[model samples]
Target chain A: MTRRRLQILMPWAVTLGLFALWEAFCKISGIEVFILPAPSDAWAAGVEFWPQLLEHSLQTLFTTTAGFVLAVGFGVLLGLAIGSSTLVYKGLYPVLVGFNSIPKVALVPVLVIWFGIGTVPAIITAFVISFFPIAVNVATGLATIEPELTDVLRSLGASRREILAKIGLPRAMPYLFASLKIAITLSFVGSVISETVASNSGIGYLMLAASSNYNVPLVFAGLLVVAFLGVLMYALMALVEGRMTGWAFRGTDLMS
Target chain B: MSDPEFHPADFMKPADFMGPADFIKVDGVDMTFSRGEEEVHALRGLDLSIPKGRFVAVVGPSGCGKSTLMRLLTGLAKPSAGTVTLEGAALRGPAKGVGMAFQNASLLPWRSTLSNVMLPFEIVAPHKRRLRANRAEYEARARALLKTVGLEAFADNQPWELSGGMQQRANVARAIVHEPRLMMLDEPFGALDAFTREELWSVMQALWMERGFTAVLITHDLREAVYLADEVLVMSARPGRIVHRQEIDLPRPRTLEMTYEPPFQAHVHSLRDHIQTVREAH
Candidate 1:
């Protein structure tokens, strides 16, 4: 195979080999099924609890998607507001940094109290955790425009709105998409954590119930679902990002 | 030696001064920039007046405020002590009739090249107001402009799909598609390779000649200035004052062949000497 194709396929082959070894070690050592189920056992558990697992998976997906979309919307708007004006950026930067530094997980109890146990608290938790990176990335993107480009636009008598639309937003897309990929994965984690702490729905709740009952295979199934969801969301985001900011990725091949 | 055809406004004026038929005037201008208690004098007592259809080039070293002058002329920056006037009116802010291009072709990557070129039409008034109703007409004009810059084939392509020279050409098309009377080019060819830069020089010259619009080109390359400008203004080092203004007595419709001639060499040598003196003085 060509080096490029080998590089691409090598990681998957390694991962598959590792999984096979893990299954063999578990079976040979005769580990308790409740402690560390084999991959086959986990798959069987998934098939048996398919209906409940599907429901919980859908709940996690919904909350994660809702939280991610809201975070992106608010984050981009806030970022633009902060990025465009020097005075506002300075004024809000310290407060934003302070808020971002606080452990967002600690706010779970407060969020549950405020939003109640269902999807609301979980979504809010995800939003709280994932919004900061998006805002920071977008603000950096918008603020870091080439001064010469702005000068050219200004001399063209372009209006402030035109500058924002043509220069600011387009330039920020790559950074925005990058932050989005990070934020989407975090959103899933946030949703699961919040669901574990507060909700009776979602993959997090399934894992918690399975662990209490000593159903290790079922717990593994729940984790597998979460992993699948995270990968799927991340892949979706990557696809969108590639479509939108493909131009940003060009011209980097020579450097690479 | 006054002829009847030569009006009083046409005679006895500084060769660089805008005659009665001129469109824009930069009167004795001074610009000083302050950053954290240190002041940098960028332009000092600068004056230049551009006739309606003349192509003027300003050549200077780095940080000599050639760009500052372009900004002042376009009203992007007001001179600290003097004024820029357009058609006898004081320019208080960015003149809507002015269009600009730069060394970096700042085309919006998300938009197609044709759409990028049509962007100004959607922002500037009259055109902006008419664009919605006459979208086809404006798109046609943008396409024609792109074609003139040899980028008609890439009209639908994103900015990244284009080469550096092609992107810069698209940038030029974007600047001029609005059909502005005054075009300000600040080192637009500085980022390109030697051959690409020379190629763009001709493209720009042809565009200016066809449009009959006044142009102010700010370049560090002496050959570029001599080849394209009707009058070349050389500014001194920081606290950049217009130290010398040389009218290119060379016949117009100047070709690349002229750049090799004795007169052309002399002009380039003389300008280089003056710039060296300015650099050494500072």
Candidate 2:
């Protein structure tokens, strides 16, 4: 096969191979469903509870996407400020680092206490968790513009605002998209964490309820849905990246 | 192969006087930068002048602060002592309507070659305001210039799609498209291989002859300096100042073959000798 064809097929082959190995291991070991459900058991349970699984998956997706959209809007503005100015960057960077270092899961109860057990807390958690990467990446992109390029613009009497608008933002777009891929996954993690801690719906809550009832196969199904959603969102991000900033990846296989 | 229009009498006289006709004047200029705690003196007591529409090249060894001089001339930097003036007015900040091209092509990868050439119109005044209304006219001019550089075919292509020589051609096109009164080039062909660099010298000559803009080129290549400039200025080592000045009174539109001839070789050799002396004096 051609390299491009192999590139497309390789991931699917590896994933299928891993699932086959898992099924073989479970069969040989005669593992209990509660201890480790087989892929077949998970698939069977997923089909039986298809409606419930769909609803919960949709809830998780909604909260993650809502939170992610807000994060993108707010984080990009903060990033532009931090990146363009020395004062904002120095003042906020250490505080941002400290804030990012604090385990976001630890904030769940405080969010729950303020907002109560539902989508609100989950959305807030997702927003807080995802915004940091987007902000930092955008700032880094703006700050690292080539000096020679800056000279070309400055010599033409381009204002600072013009430079930021014309060159800095477009240059930062690839960085922004790269960070979106990371932030989207993190948003899912944040929403799910909130949901499991205190929520009536979502895949996280379903998994928690399934574990309590010893429905290990159902819990495995929930995990699979979340993983599928994360991969789908990541692929979407990569597609947008390819469309918008393909020039940044010229001469690279990534664009193809 | 000399045309009847080629005037040997004009090439015979050297440019020795500095006044009235001078477009830019740098007098007793000094540039010092504080790196960490120590003050590194880049240029000291530098004095130079360029006549209007003259193409002058500054050549020196590495770290001789040739770039510092260009910065001063372009109004990107202020001298620690003395003054840099254009026409007669002293520059307080970045000079207006200056076009610059660097060693790196520095075209925006996001913009196509045609769009990159038209970039100055988006930044420069009057033009920036008139661009939306007269975009077709401006675009036609950009296409014409690209044709002169032999890059008209690649105008719609992305900057990364072009080879290094082609990208540099676009770079030169972008620099001149705005029709600025003054142009600064910082080793604009330094990164190219010998053949490409020589090829660009002809392209550069054609452009300058057509535009008649005052140009200041900073380069280490003596041949490039001699090939492209009306006069070549050599700088001393650190705490740099002009140590030698050679007027290259060659005929217009000099060919690449002329570079191998004795007259051109003599100019290059003389510059090389001056640079050697400057390096040893360090």
Candidate with top TM-score is: 2
Q: Over 4 Å off in model 1, which ranges?
A: A1-12, A251-256, B1-22
**So what's the TM-score on candidate 2?**
0.94
lDDT of 1 by residue, B212-278 (tens): 8888899989999999998898888887877888888898677888899999999999999988988
TM-score of 1: 0.90
Query: DockQ for each of the predicted structures, in order?
Result: 0.44, 0.64
Q: Write the per-residue lDDT of candidate 2 for residues B150-201, one digit (tens) a residue.
A: 9999999999899999999999999999999899999989999999999999
Alpha-carbon shift of residue B198 in model 1 (angstroms): 2.9
Badly placed stretches (over 4 Å) of model 2 are B1-20
Among these predictions, the greatest DockQ belongs to 2
